[model samples]
Target chain A: MNLQVSRFQFFSIVLNFIIYSSILMAPGITVINAKQDGWLSMLLALGVGLAANFLYLMLFKKHGYPSLFELMDRSAGKWIGTALNIVIVFYALHLTAMVVRNLSNFMITDVSPYSSPYIYQILILLVVAYTSYHGVKNLFLISELFTPFISLFVIGSLIVIIKHFKIIELKPFFYNPPSAILEGAYSTLGFPFIEIMLAGAFLTYVKRKDKLVSIALSAIAIGGAVLVITVILVIGNDSAYIVARESYPTYSVMRDVSLTTTFKRVEIIIGIAWIIGLFFKISTCFCVAMMGIKHLSKSKTFRGYIVPCAILVWAMSNGLHKTFIDFTNFVSMDWTLYWFTLYSFVIITMLIGLARKRA
Target chain B: MQDWKTTMKANKTTREKIVLAIVWGFSLYYIIGYLAGIDPFPITVWLKAIYGPIYHTLFGG
Candidate 1:
């Protein structure tokens, strides 16, 4: 069955994908490294992300919107492409596992300190596997339908927190040394930003190819703005020290917001937004990995793989880190570098394909 | 050289079998590790050991 997503849906998918896990953890990570300058680090990351997106766009244009698997096939030949797809599939699965683990870890540690991570893990996996089994159209549809609510929740949090914002807390901006700021920018650039390469998985499904670049840029810009706002508010309201110390600064800031004299603890809105966004994120990664697997194996049935995929993710995520600190240290010290290196090879191969085409 | 598209379309290729085997093997290791309460991320440990210094050198914690 052929699947197609309208440009609007494509835009929403990009927005949702980038915002997925970043809102909860990225601000804390950045604050620890860059302090008050974390927002500026995000700004730097945005510029780098846009350029990288432009490169992917050009590569897509040259290759005529092949899915990442098919693009590798065309550019690198059958055997090599299949091999590359194996690696890409592994990377995608690992990412999905991390997203799952991160969400479960956050819920267990921050929101419900009494609950077991396994419960959230099973709950999230079921939902992710369910959505992924339906195919790509449903994934985009869900994102299109849910992104507005996520946006509204984030906007509401910002509005409610505005009165609590202290300009003094945002002071000493750019106070971090150059290395610290660059390090923050480097990690941010590596993540939610460069991970936009995952968009290639759905590139073929986008109906209006002419508008692809614009849709991508707008999505990246909007997603970057969301991250910037998240960092600024976290720092502006709670200060960099609190943001650095806390595991989920964005959630903290949102939870701290009071709607009025009577209404407090408005974090449910943010929680809903996060859960919906994470659903889309994990589902997208799951779907894309399965798609790549299907393409590589030339299998006709994708549904058959969904449960196995979920089981694999569950095991890998469970085994990959024994504790939240292990998870954080791995993502901090290894994941960024590993993903950047992996995708950099992909971009290089694509660029080589482009060069060969020109030659 | 086998024509990949033809091989994949006609039947499960050898490469597919190899990939499946490898994936299943890795999955089994993880599953058994979980059951045995063993660490499943030696790769993570190894990479962190190797990359941690390089990362700190390049970016400085």
Candidate 2:
């Protein structure tokens, strides 16, 4: 009801959304498409993501504190607003399911062949549903608590992997075709970055309306930069072919960790960080889905829908597609063009329309 | 004024009780079981019944 989250809490939420799934897989995917120039495409993707964030901020400024639902109502009228909300809600749920299935597949393939993928999905969904049911305040608190530990693990992993870095591995920077680099940028842009469109749903909760733009922009910049650096490190250290072949390249990089016989098998440490960050990402998406349902139902209490919604989400993940490749292909070609472009246009148009009306 | 105060107090207490029950139930059912090494069979079955077919169809077991 208060509709105002603290700056740090806001940062934690955005960071959580930006950190998972993509960070683990983007470098590998990028190298597959962009070869030795994968890091360059990643940087380009970050810039594109930042530009998209700016456009979102422009819209937020014009609307003051209106949530995405409210903004849609004001801009498009009731019938259109309701339809758009349905579209976005279904999209949000689909993306949430995609992330869950993707992470489950990664765990099965990269972490442990013993555990069933269903086990990982249910466990992750339970954690996400529990956190989301408590509402955003609890979600923020949990993220803040895990933030320090995740940060330390990421930093420690980078440090541990630094000794294995070979300068010669980065020698052939332009080996990949130019078209491939462009295609990789397009794909990466669709993922972890452009997907920031989902953040607009949560941004309305930030208390300091005046600082929202600065905070959101800074989060994107910092998150994207962290991702780009990780990509560079992954590409610089591993052969492009090896990097491209792995499902979870960064996790594989962690597997390569052998620091003077003391810090071997650091994949577990990376696994812990991945689990925590992935939980936050799934939880944030689940929260948005809950909010979308509340807006649709015009209900004040969102907690009632959590169980049914979680069940539906688990079922929907099964219905969507199979394999990580199908999921990746959807994100790259379909989701990037349709969901990303549509929301970007709608938000930008709403911002301009609101601004003109105010004038 | 007295009636308003009484109603407000009642609502506040009800909300607090609900929150407590939820927190306690979630911790006991989810976190505690996870910590105590309980196999998450029921939840996995529910998920598998939903997702297994998709993977099976797409990847072809």
Candidate 3:
């Protein structure tokens, strides 16, 4: 087990983790709450998200036992550390379920309406399981390979659609109060921003830890910038009232892009890119969850849990929400605060553990 | 080794094989039940019950 990934690969990991499911939905999620000034909310989340990234980095001690799970044990003693690990494991698994559901919902609602979501779920799950079977580095390598395609397709679509951005869509910018805008940021702050910390659980395997901070924070910056631009472009091109109503607004906005008489259907490219992103995301979460179980059980190999975890993720995805609307309701309203609360719990425990070490 | 669990392996222990079987059984119970159109309990029931009061209160019923 001499596994180690380069900072470049780690950057790809964080980059994929940051933008995954957020690329399409972030605009709609923000606009729904903050109305026309939704990009502002995204900017606000980016600022907080970067600061949270800094705080997460600070939690990684420079000395021995730099791993977060190890740090928990060193700080809080055995039981609390184990408990914290369990919390992360559950969060990772649940988040995997959520991502699986997200992709399935997108395919069902936006792509093909007649198919059962489980069909999509099982298809992705099998690949995710195979990725897990190959290990975390495989996920990282694939992220590195696929990231450019996702970014290129996404940004290219944005560039093509930029000419359509009528500043009129952003008129009456401050119509939503600060509280409403803040609510928009709050909904997404946990989703696209905080979930990057999941990479921290496994990044200790990076051989050269120097510049980890720069790599991760820059991923946050780039990911958030892409998201903010998407918000502006989509809302700028389409009405907030209308974009806010759609499940995947950016995709729909991209759907209307026409390079010429023969060159439309940009949404399909974005759709495929999204699948790649979701694949990386689901694989990463599955790996993280497997790590949590491995750490807790002191198992000889976490790869052994891959199949079990994949099946559970598939099961959980199918079982979590009865309808796509329910999933959206959870995401827009509860997703942020839920992750927000969980991060608070983990942060407080870490702080207490750090203080205990000082004493 | 920190990497042992995360690095892919080519072989599995007997215990892991057994665990896999058990997991397959557990999953089949739900997957088959769902295909048969039997969903006794969904995760949303518990999730809604827990966060129900909060988000429901804010967003309305």
TM-score of each: 0.93, 0.82, 0.89
Q: Find the candidate with the highest TM-score and give its number.
A: 1
Q: How accurate locally is residue A342 in candidate 1, as Cα lDDT from 0 to 100?
A: 71
Best candidate per lDDT, number? 1
Task: Quote model 2's iRMS.
Answer: 11.0
- Candidate number with the higher DockQ (2 or 3): 3
Clash number for candidate 3: 1
- lDDT for A205 in candidate 2 is 79
Q: List, residue by residue over A230-295, the lDDT tens digit for candidate 1.
A: 888878999888888888888888887777778888877787788888888888888889898888
Better of 1 and 2 by DockQ: 1
Candidates in order have lDDT scores of 0.82, 0.73, 0.80
lDDT of candidate model 2 versus the reference: 0.73
| Model 2 lDDT tens row, A17-135 | 77665778888878877887888888888888888778777777767757877777777778877777766776677678778888888888988887888888899999888887777
lDDT of 3 by residue, A54-103 (tens): 88777664333266677677667898887888778778988999999999
Q: Name the lDDT of candidate 3.
A: 0.80
Where model 3 places Cα greater than 4 Å from the true spot, the runs are: A62-65, B1-43, B55-61
The deviation in Å at residue B56 for candidate 1 is: 1.8
